[model samples]
Target: MVNQNNSAQSVEKTPSVDDKNLMNIAQYLKGVQQSHKRSIPPLDQWHPKHCGKMDLTVKANGEWWHEGQLIKRQALLDLFSSVLWKEEGKFYLKTPVEQIEIEVEDEPLLVSQVDQVDIDGKLYLQLTTTNQDVVVVDDQHPIFMRDYAGERRPYVHVRFGINALIQRHVFYHLVELGELDETEQGKAILVLKSGDLLLQLDS
Candidate 1:
């Protein structure tokens, strides 16, 4: 579940298009957690029929919601993430028998830490997600920027077509590690790396 921080707050909640459908998925999540024993199940192998649309959402700030209420359980989010899959440019969670679609406001994952290395004249970068999964930032998992409401934010590919937003402190660290590289078009790009792991900075 992703609960580094969890507290119940009765603030006004965001409306969901399918709250009833989403709540059922939340209850079903408990079964998945119990049966899988806290590890990720083979969601890719499971091609179950679509149960329905889940009104579950991963907010822009990384908070998760179900049925218009804060989940308040990071563990629950982590559990759902274990079976999370993306197909046809959409996101879904799969249990052994059920598959449910979820809404994601932005990227579902977040970069929580950054590490760098240099070897043999090459640089590489490693990023840690909020889920504690570590992924190397390379050509395969490239880092770039996205525009959200006219503000630019840094993002990196984690895995399975999911991008993790680089947290503020880690972004600052990456900035300090950044250097200028000439592009093929002769334009300069600000980037950081550890070996072949290249992270591009965009304005």
Candidate 2:
């Protein structure tokens, strides 16, 4: 009887591990989806703001300006590295180390390559690419730079640079993979064809 009870307990514990693993997999997939969405910026509309010009050689000494209002360069770089934009051409940052690279085709795309394992101890497919671009603009405007006696403190503005073409590409890929169900609105949820969902969870 004791042996039988021990066996039952072991079986129960097995599923608990599996459940925990599934939850973890779900969270990882969710994170990847969110990151992909964030890398692209909206470029469908444009608004203009007024900016002041100043001489770089002269410092705005005795000028009463707000402190801690300036955006740090590292912050801007971090923003740009995560988000996609287009200035001269298509640009984006690859994850892990956030290496910036540009897509050269007529239609640019951002590729995210990830390695995932399955619950069955087998490897599976989770590799995919998304279309995106990086928008680069000169921060010559004094409003972007504090203490604007103009020291060539060029600021790089980062934002989404998505268009109809890229949007269609995303839509089509999801549809082609049969991952698109009418269940969600404004977003695509992919059903991965490879890799055990449970293994991915543990990973």
Candidate 3:
């Protein structure tokens, strides 16, 4: 996992009423409103054939079909997860942060971020403030989910702050998954059949 050097002390600062007021104003300006544009057709309304089958195979040396085209290894990773592992390794689905113990200076840090699981099981990324206040990043926010179309699918989104900690949790699972592969170049990719596309950790 990469080390994030931001001071843990920053988590101890308290926000003033002025700060709270500004945050409220921001939310008021940005909260979701009824759009004048045409509404998206319901997922159930779509024909079964239009909704692609959920495929979970690891394609290290094989090809995976995407949008009616056969995409090979590197291209598949780029298209799906937007991440390229330096070495061929398995990646696993991460466990929720609430299940782990996170501490700073021997004191347990309050969980300021909440875990969000979409219907499909993909995790959403989130951050928190020092006051133990939760800040749910808008799914439409550029830094949160990228592909809105992908997000519409069945998937889960879990939120957590502290990038390094999140990476640690993810990589820990990756390593565990790596142990299950028979080939050295074989890799595992978490596929969200339906969910948000943005890689928040990259942001």
Candidate 4:
């Protein structure tokens, strides 16, 4: 139930974006992360009137940097990853009281590994992110391809509005597991099937 500042005009009253402001926001988010260890913060419920853009950036390889300096603390990266909010194609670190925009060179997360699981005669694909987040590929968390550097690369929805780019080697392994299938238009495609769910790797 966190809320923004007192007035909608609070944007004019908020502190300017600076190194000190970044540090303050990071510390505040750290405390919030600790309180929500068993679950992600209620970011969708929190509303901030003005979200200012900042120099924080997540590199394509999933390295987080603040002002051109790498964030070496895995704990901070994990903490910030939890509050990542997306709006209108931009990224931000959000909290109940504040929202700070950040740059993302690619997807906010990276898929480091994947596994196939079978239960009750049903098959599923499980993905693990660099931050240790695990999600099963299903209707809600499906894989889709996007044009990256002139090539189509696969990405999977991780959580909230965040997505993880599948590492190249891992993506190759997924292609190996796929079988040839035909589209409704009778065009051949590569696909991976798990139980009743089917994903086209090549479109």
- TM-score: model 4 vs. ground truth: 0.80
lDDT of 4 by residue, 64-156 (tens): 888778989877677778788888888988877788888999989988898999967888888888777788898989988888778778899
Against the hidden true structure, what lDDT does model 1 obtain? Answer: 0.73
| C-alpha lDDT of candidate 3 relative to the true structure | 0.27
The whole-model C-alpha lDDT of candidate 2 against the native structure comes to: 0.30
Please, what is the whole-model Cα lDDT of each candidate in the order they appear? 0.73, 0.30, 0.27, 0.79
Model 3 agreement with the true structure over 41-83: per-residue lDDT tens digits: 2222222221111223323222333333453544223222211
Off by over 4 Å in 1: 1-39, 117-123, 180-188
What TM-score does candidate 1 get on C-alpha atoms?
Answer: 0.73
**Candidate 3 lDDT for residue 175:** 33
In model 3, the worst 10-residue window by lDDT is: 93-102
Stretches > 4 Å off in candidate 4: 1-17, 34-38, 180-188
Top-TM-score candidate index: 4
Give candidate 3 misplaced runs (Cα > 4 Å): 1-114, 117-184, 191-195, 198-203
